[model samples]
Target: MDHNISKHISGNFNQELENVRNHVLAMGGLVEQQLNSALDAVNDSNAELAKKVEHGDYKVNAMEVSIDEECTRIIAKRQPAASDLRLVVAIAKTIADLERIGDEARRIAKVALESTAKDQQGLLGNIDNMGRHVSQMLHDVLDAFARMDAEAAFRVHKEDAKVDREYEALTRQIMTYMMEDPRSIPKVMDLVWSVRSLERIGDRCQNIAEYVIYFVKGKDIRHTSQDDIERDIIGK
Candidate 1:
């Protein structure tokens, strides 16, 4: 009877942990959707869509608060240690990243709403491509978190470099456009801000990937070199 009671308690604790994790993932999904919608608004020059994205940020913020509270409750009630402790810490940190990503998305939407540039000028296409890359990075990192796959997280970390390069290239192009035509400066400046936001989103995704590694290996690999991170995860 004692063993049965102990087992039941353990099962309940595990369920609580799972619930918190699911909430974090759900929050990530909402942030991803918000980002995609913001990007679409930029591409289509749709103020209505931008407004919708802005409004959706509230839901993301609420999810962050909910998941955070649940994590705190589990930690206090269950007194989890070892791997379970790591899991909760990771979920908390990842949710923070997700919230910041939502902020970046909201900023992008604001830029879209303010932008008056209707001409494609090929800049929108470039921005769209960059947005798609970062979006995929977010999706992949979230999948890694769901599966707790350190290898997958590492792969996503590597992809961030490509996003950085794309951001730099886009900035250079926008600068050139502004110089060639001063009348385009205001619109190009808005595009620059949007690009910067997308770049920051990539950085946030990489941070989540680091959290995945931390959760899996009990190592904080935030500032570690790429080669070292690869060695650490692969060696394990």
Candidate 2:
């Protein structure tokens, strides 16, 4: 193709990219809702709310598959190079992160459904707080992606430590309770799973933030710590 024709095709190719991004955003919205619903279900011991989350997982999975295929098709057809390739690669990775986040949310809902709680107050409250933070982290990471704002992405990365700390505290507390009273063992087991799912969700949020940094600067932030990312490069 001539330069003019190639340019035209590239412009059209952007539409495909935009479509995938939009679909991913839509999936993100649903995942966000699923997290909230899962938290509520756990707090209230509502099997119905958990069921809603279970059903929503199917849609999230389907969206991820559709977006991945579209990105693949666009690249195969356009043969994008340089920054164009970067953007496409970023989209593909972002979709995977979103899908995993959806899976984490599903896991949380499943725990809620299976749990039999003697004390809903502590187990549900701690994990719910963690879930809210993770959800907000994801929201900001997505915003950074849409805006191409590396600084905002860096800020979201710092938030992961808070979630991790909460997860640790919850784990210790739940384990102590189980040890103190063996009868609480059954319920505490489910709480452990609940806390674990929330922690994984936070981890995935961090992954998304790393991707945002990658998308913005073409930098690999995965192996590096938050302090390293901020002080070594993103800060400067």
Candidate 3:
């Protein structure tokens, strides 16, 4: 009985909405697992683990398609209004972000598979640290979504700043490595893409946080400054 899901006269309608929300959570769980495995693949340089992560992207894509279709059917049949409509819209947007996060994880896994030289692999510093930070942000934002707590969502939104800082530091470190030895460019470039993917995943998590705020407050905060968002929404 999430307050956002209306208690309809028709019990079936209530159940349908609940089922869709549950499906979104299940998909979130799978995507989180995929990301953790991708990190392991990179840290261990296990080609087998990396290949498994790349193969798992299809499952994420399939779930996104299924959830989108279900949301469309709900809109067409239920014609929900107010909070209910917002819930459907939020779920649709959240899944799209989750799918893209999965894509970034797959991209990171590719870095492991592409490394041909041990020395080239050694050119990059430990990415697992930044990977863990983004992973926690994703987990927190999803928790905020499940509870539909706008304040909690805002807290998660703030964490993206730290991820950005980490990405910038890593980029500078990797660039220095390439400059010191231009011969490592080819392998280091793959590492660059992997770190960039990590940053993009942070952005996607922030997008989900905005969707949560939108669903609960009925306010779209996209392209808005963090200071303004707090003053306009959470500070109130």
Candidate 4:
């Protein structure tokens, strides 16, 4: 390739990378909005809000497609090597995670529709808190990814345990309620599913945090002891 043409190709690849980043952020933003709407639907028991979430999922799906196509073009044309290759793969996987997270939010909205219990009836113990915490975790993970901040990502990872504890506490309460009044089982069960969906969202946030660390540091950082990751993350 001629020198000027080589420079032009390099510019084009960088622009493509930027496009990939923008698309991922767009997907993340949609998922974030979905989470908020899901929680609102649960609190208000509004079927319309739930329906909106289900339909808005298409935007997240399309963002993933656009990002995938651009990433594929760059991979085949530029053949990003070494660190660049790793970044491409990380971006792809992160987009997948975000899309899955959106699916879980839609599921929560579905459960909201099935529920007959009012948000203020105390039928779903501590779930309001759970929704807030899990949503904040998602926000933090995406912020970490946008800034490439490994430290912030690790903080989000550590917060997952807190969300789990909250979920478990809520579960025990629901079990106690079910035992005290057998007739309440059907109505209370929907709360169980909604809270469970929030817990799953927390788990996905942890996965997103791990991916952020991977992309920022080019490290796997998966299924390892926390101490080991902290030790290596600092060194890197």
TM-score of each predicted structure versus truth: 0.92, 0.90, 0.93, 0.89
lDDT of 4 by residue, 154-196 (tens): 9999898999899899999889988998888887887888888
Lowest-scoring 10 consecutive residues by lDDT in candidate 1?
1-10
- Please state every model's RMSD to the true fold in angstroms: 4.3, 4.3, 2.2, 4.7
- How high is the CA lDDT of each candidate model? 0.86, 0.78, 0.87, 0.81
Span of 10 residues, lowest total lDDT, candidate 4: 1-10
Predicted candidate 1 versus true structure: per-residue lDDT over 1-236, tens digit per residue: 12212332345576677677778878999999999999989887789999999999999999999898998888888898777788888899999999999999998887767756556449889889999999999999999988888888999998999999999999998898888889888767888898999999999999999988887777998778899988866463
Error of 4 at 200 (Å): 1.5
lDDT of 3 by residue, 2-116 (tens): 6644432245578887888889999999899889889888888878988998899999999999999999999999998877788889999999999999999999998878764
Return the top candidate by lDDT: 3
* Model 2 stretches astray by more than 4 angstroms: 1-12
The numbered model that scores best in TM-score is 3
What tens digits encode model 2's per-residue C-alpha lDDT throughout 180-226?
88987876787788788878877887777777677666788888876
Q: Which portions of model 4 miss their true places by more than 4 Å?
A: 1-12, 118-120
For candidate 4, the lDDT comes to 0.81
